[model samples]
Target: MLENKVALVTGAGRGIGREMALMMAAHGAKVVVNDPGVSLEGKDETDGPANEVVRDIKAAGGDAVADYGSVSDSASAKAMVTRAMDTFGKIDVVVNNAGILRDVIFHKMTDEDWDSVIKVHLYGSYYVSRAAAEHFRKQESGTFVHMTSTSGLVGNPGQANYSAAKMGIIGLSKSLALDMAKFNVRSNCISPFAWSRMIGSIPNTPDQEERLKSLRMLTPDKIAPVAVFLASDDSKEVNGQIFAVRGNEVFLMSQPRPLRSVHRSEGWTPETLRDHMLPTLKPSFIPLHMSRDVFSWTPV
Candidate 1:
């Protein structure tokens, strides 16, 4: 589906990003595999991961190039897109799959924790998309596949930074879809339930061992095909959409919508809201549930 196209996949060193890069290349997309091999918390950078992926692609008769650029930096992000153009002459798809985890409860979260996660996930997505936007506009065609998370879409504990960034990506993807539709550019988000290094970082408790086994079933490779479809003309009509990919289940997730509303002719006073609106809206109130709570069933 991606013959002759050029794809830029950030964080292609490993996990989901690596799978996306490989799958896109297998389908004939010249891939710019961008990865500044960093530890899960964004430390200890190396070029080994990116280089290895490039070698694997080449060995498999697929075109690919390694880009050891940190997505957290605006200049580096832009340079990655520029590298695609320089190497392949054009960039058709951008999978903003680069990310880092800084899990801490909201009260204990430090400035660095918040800033680092936001910069890489939210700001990184923006910078790369902005760089590609100019080219997409000039050429009048492009596709963006942003990696989001159920933690953001629903809720999660000790991930204020991650959840906020992922949710912000949803808004970003929606805005890009609306703004770039005229230029034939499409933007969509994927909330993957994949067991990756990121997921491996989560502290596993003896109580949650069984749940961990279920999570392991949802591998990163399962996410690649959905991203490929979103990036291809096959999904030309799919934009501003959110997809949650579990083991064998693909879900079109719900966006925010009014479940119930209450009004008063006199307008709502604090007391009136407390007494009337509270009672009327109580049944419709969404529960303060974590991602696991909502996804209680074993993925298949």
Candidate 2:
């Protein structure tokens, strides 16, 4: 479906990013597999994953090349997009999947932890998307798939930094969607819950691992098809939206809820809030929960 398209997938060296890169290539995209090849904590590495993915794609009769650039840096991000353009003539799709984890409670979170996570997930997306948007604007047709996480939606304990960065992508994607629509460019965010190295390494016992696997609703491979759909022309009308993708499941995320309140003519007091407003507040009112469902191939 992506025939003749050139795609740049950040962090495509391993996990979901790697799978997405391979899938895009199999679908006829000339892919630029960009990855710093770091560990789950965003440290340590080898270029093996990115190189292996490229080799696998080539063996499968698909075209792809490896890029060992850190998407967190503006210069490197620009070079990644340029590599796609130089190698394949033009870039048609960008999957901003590069990220790092700095899981910690708010009170315990360090400045370094907060900065690093934001740098890779939020600023990294900004750097690469900004560069790609320029090329897409000129072409008047392009696709951007931002990698968000369920932590950003439901909020996981001890992941304040991670959640903040992930949720920021949603806002960024929505604003970009509105801005890029005039050029026929589409931008969307996906909050994925899948088993990957990051999840696997999360300190679990053998029994715990088995139990968690059974309960998992998504796998890395399942997430790729949605990415492919978003990157293809099929999703032309699907812009300014966020989706939660899991195994055979796809659902739209709801917007933030606005608070409704009653105003008093005179100055409010603590007693008034306790006696009147407290009772008036609806405890049964459920906050918006994003939709989740199994998805099949259909036009946007």
Residue 59 lDDT in candidate 1: 98
- Tell me which residue pairs clash in candidate 1: none
Ten residues in a row with the worst lDDT in model 1? 200-209
Clashes of each: 0, 0
lDDT of 2 by residue, 1-300 (tens): 899999999999888899899999999999999988888788868988899999999999999989999888899999999998888899999999998887766898899999999999999999999999999999899999999877777666677888889889988998889999999999998877677777665544475554565435456887899899999998888998888876666889887876667678896899998887777776645554421212223212
TM-score, prediction 1? 0.99
Candidate 1's displacement at residue 113, Å, is 0.6
